[model samples]
Target: MPEQTQDDTGRDRDDDGRARNARPRDRFGRPLPFGSAGVPRIPEDLDLPPAETLDYAQRLLDEGLAFNAHEVLEAAWKNGPFAEKSLWQGLAQFAVGLTHIQRGNAKGARTLLKRASDRLSAYGTAPYGIDSPGLVDRAHTLLMALEQGKPISDTDLRARLTISH
Candidate 1:
């Protein structure tokens, strides 16, 4: 047998030798074959303003791309202000819950939704115009539907991150 090429970490690396997943991913963020064309990726370093982050994430959700939305929210959570970390993290969890539902992982969906609800609840009032109470209610509704064995459609799962003025 021929010797296999190996790296110290055995992980994919960027041209500069930084670790990164260079694989293309589907709209759901599942990895595709190396040569297959796939959905564009959300940048890991994306650090948009709060309103822009919410808007971009909301658009992704509307497109039934919850996984990508989660990435955007995760980036915001990681790169945003400390005071708003919980809020962004909660939004990321909410998106991931939807992503789990899309991927047919009922248990994961339930767990993530519950966690998102708890975090959103701590806000008490809307922060950055985010409808935290509505999101908490939405999470509870989705959990109830899941428990009842109801099917959640992609359209039904799309969430509005902010209150409409």
Candidate 2:
């Protein structure tokens, strides 16, 4: 088969002379790239150590800003060493699940939260700090409520996780 050629308008003419749109364009008529825009820019001179990543996640949880926390922790998790990667990944999933719950998407929350629990459960709450087990327990409890067609109370959830008032 011969190679087809695309014109400036992104229309390609095959050997059989059929013209087809080769690429999709954005709303402003610019051609969309194949991959994501780009990786988020990380500071080259970042001073915070890898161990502090979980601390940031905890603070996000405390402030009820799970989504942003997930973003930060996920990046750190990916770049972290293999030994502790699962732990960080689990925390990121947990935070994402809580964010879903906050947005009233119990189904989505259940999926990610279950994954988080499963991943974290294996370690038996060793490296995850003092409140780690409580957070996991609270996430599981909320997941059960979501599964059983019960409404979850914000106060109850907070108390279960021991998030101080």
Winning candidate number (TM-score): 1
TM-score of each: 0.90, 0.62
lDDT of 2 at 127: 56
Clashing pairs in 2: none
lDDT of each: 0.87, 0.64
Please list the residue runs of candidate 1 whose C-alpha ends up more than 4 Å from where it truly belongs after superposition. 1-9, 15-18
Taking the candidates one at a time, how many backbone clashes does each contain? 0, 0
Q: How well is each residue in 1-165 modelled by candidate 2, as lDDT tens digits?
A: 335677667677766667743334332223356453532332322334554765665665565566656766687677777887787787778877877777788888899999988877865654534245766887778888889978776554452222334
lDDT of 2: 0.64
What TM-score does candidate 2 reach? 0.62
